[model samples]
Target: MPLSRTVRCICIEISKKRFNPKSLEKLEIIPASQSCQHIEIIATMKKTGEKRCLNPESKAVENLLKAVSKERSKRSP
Candidate 1:
């Protein structure tokens, strides 16, 4: 499905930051248009399992979250 305009805007904001694969828990690309794509990242809390969409505008926070996610993966089997 095509991403909403708000999501598209958020994705645009995200693309401007430094790319760090380690910071992202899960990243998926959803087709937005014939010439563009939308990105979705999983933003969740480790202790509570609460989930939310990544905020594209917050580079520092996103990077930190992604790092945490990476650490969790390493701790798992």
Candidate 2:
């Protein structure tokens, strides 16, 4: 028998409704692919170093992403 090899989505269950942008240490955006059919947003908490999965379709998530992008652009030369 051959062993089937396949990548899997890291997040099992998405986190609660909202997150504090200031508390987010990092945000990782995973595009839809074979393993995961939908966009996945993962956030790392600054203090606890905990990871949380967020809903990509939420308005709050959109705003948080925009803010992070803007901040990064400002830092770039």
Error in Å for residue 20 of model 2: 1.4
**Model 2 alpha-carbon drift over 4 Å, by segment:** 1-7, 68-77
Instruction: Identify the leading candidate in terms of lDDT.
Output: 2
Task: Please list the C-alpha lDDT of all candidates, in the order they appear.
Answer: 0.51, 0.79
Model 2 C-alpha lDDT per residue in residues 1-77, reported as the tens digit of each score: 66334346777788875766777787789988998777788888899999988878765577787887999999999
Model 2, position 60: C-alpha lDDT score = 52
Which numbered prediction scores highest in TM-score against the true structure? Answer: 2
Tell me the tens digit of each residue's lDDT in model 1 across 39-69: 4554444445544455445564556657779
C-alpha TM-score for every candidate: 0.32, 0.69
